[model samples]
Target: MRQSYQDWKGQSIEAKRSQLRGETKDLPVPVHIQKEPPFWDVFPENPEVFKLVVQARALGVLRLEENRNTEEKVIRYTRETVIGSENVEIASSWEEAVQVLEVLACRPDKEAIGRQVSAKLADADQAQDKLGLYDQFINYLKQREAELEKIGGSDSPDYKREATIIKDLITSENLQLDNKSKLSVIQLVISPEKPLVDFIEEPHISNISPVEPPFMAGANVFCTECGEQNPARSKFCYNCGTRLVKPN
Candidate 1:
């Protein structure tokens, strides 16, 4: 989840210039500039998607915590903005996590965090609605693009993803899938050749169970540079304006 000092070539390290930023050179500064690790670099293939995850987690739009259920380590991203939430667990493996992060990072808006996630099997009770979530996001994407005049733009948003938000009023409980299966579904949704209708797989969302119990988890994220404790979901530390490096 973080890059080591060896991996960070440009970020700053401790210094002894005896220069204080705010106050005159009367005493040593309490904090030095320490850059946080570039976790997005960890997912070069899906940088944008991974970036969204970092941003959303920082904004408290979603919550991430250690997944103690399995022997193979995993981290869970559970929606917290809304009352009844939906969550998805992604593996710790960097490469596999990239594939899963792309799907989770497809959130269309910051509000409805995980609405479009695994739409194929998100809500079995409202299979029709679950299937329609992707379509709704597609429609919204088109409208958003038109608003931004991004029909032929380069910096346009990738609302075409299957996991962006398309807020649902009716709460859909639990939805979790193995890394392989989840990645496959995400790829299929983003595939140009696959028709939207094909995203629907009957009984896909039938396994919906109780939502994950909310945990009072935050401020656990720490900055490796200045040892600043950042908010749990923070991508960077506020004190020294550095990216958070996973502590050793």
Candidate 2:
């Protein structure tokens, strides 16, 4: 047989060198491979053996050896058709893929802090409804300039043109106000012995009408013993003390 297949391949290469010296006899001492040089004395711009072969192919420890002249069933059918088999073997080295993309870009998220606290509570409720409509238009222009200084003759030019039209309707930055100056101050305070013109001409016709007697301008009255509306110059019931009565 060819010298008995050359002594069975020299006893299968001394039984794989005594089973690789008994599996490297408790490990440590193996480092000697060095001398490879001569590809014109090596260093072809040495990037440290291409960064240690890209850190041993990213730590999966760069394996590949089995070719026993190829065909151990075509190298175990090309290592069982090799395709990424569930990936995750990491370490290939751009600084550990930039430290795993900086730990997934450091967290933050609650929908961007709830859209910045809903845009600062809608800019503090539009600055508190524009400071409550500028204090109800400056207390209706200081009660129409104290009822045009109590009816005009404050050295009249119709009291300096209705106090410069109630100081340009309360310092106008245009918050509006002229419904013909509140209907010419409600037709200069109506009169048929004004209990606001008998509560606007008998509001619910005559509940014994006529007791709100004092200088009546725009009366209001109500109190059938305490419903309390009061204000035709109010002699009481400033919200329930009760006793005011004069329109009869």
Candidate 3:
């Protein structure tokens, strides 16, 4: 039997609460809507929806329309479907959505979700709220750092990407992040030594000649006055300083 909207919402709330209580794994969206076209039609008009669409397309679960070529077109179509609006003026919103989409598209892992949450937390205006979120952010960094270390360490693309996000967060002047949080974030990304993979054997150049031959044809100029055999490239004789005749 199909449950009414209220019943579904109630179940959603229960699931959320269970997730928070560690009784169930937290999912960003309802299980029914995750892979269903009917729910996709009514998906929320947000970055998460865009991420889902991109992920679906990447995984061959979704296909672009016949004429949709550019990213702006994709962005427009996403808005038109998710928000039920076709009048959106694509400007800074497109840029912001694109940034979020790129991050989410590159990573199909929970780390991408964590980055989104971190960005939102960094945007908090109230100092108290920021202070409260700082511990969570630190925990995220620690977990991400450990994961990266296990897989590919500091040289991993994932590590570099997360480090870039951390660097941006710390350097953003508008963010109200505390000094301690900033320092702690910095400590996670930087390292004193380069990765071993970066070291390469230098090629042997010790026996290579530094000087070139007189010419490609081994030609030389015999000075008329001094009989000095100067290189064909020389304009003047090396011994007598006399102008060499053209060798035709």
Q: How close is candidate 1 to the true structure, as a TM-score?
A: 0.23
Best of the two (1, 3) by lDDT: 3
Candidate 1, residue 20: Cα displacement in angstroms equals 25
Estimated TM-score for each candidate: 0.23, 0.16, 0.25
Best by lDDT: 3
lDDT per residue as tens, model 1, 133-193: 4344445445545655644432445432312432321123322333334445555554453
When summed lDDT is taken over every stretch of 10 residues in candidate 2, the lowest stretch is 72-81
lDDT of 3 at 242: 67
How do the candidates rank by lDDT, highest first? 3, 1, 2
RMSD of each: 27.5, 34.3, 22.1
Q: How do the residues 1-248 of candidate 3 rate in per-residue lDDT, one tens digit apiece?
A: 22243244444444643654459655445546444223322323454444443332222233233323233332222222464633221112322333333332223322433444445545666554554444444454565578678777767876565555554543452344544444444445535331111112223532222233244445788778788676777776645456778668
Best-fitting candidate, measured by TM-score? 3
Write model 2 residue lDDT over 170-246, tens digit each, in one string. 35433332333333344455443323322223335433233443534556776667675666666655443456785
lDDT of 1 at 208: 25
- TM-score leaderboard ranking: 3, 1, 2
Query: In candidate 2, which residue pairs get closer than 3 Å at backbone N, Cα or C atoms, i.e. clash?
Result: 209-247, 209-248, 210-246, 210-247, 210-248, 211-246, 211-247, 211-248, 212-246, 212-247
Better of 2 and 3 by TM-score: 3
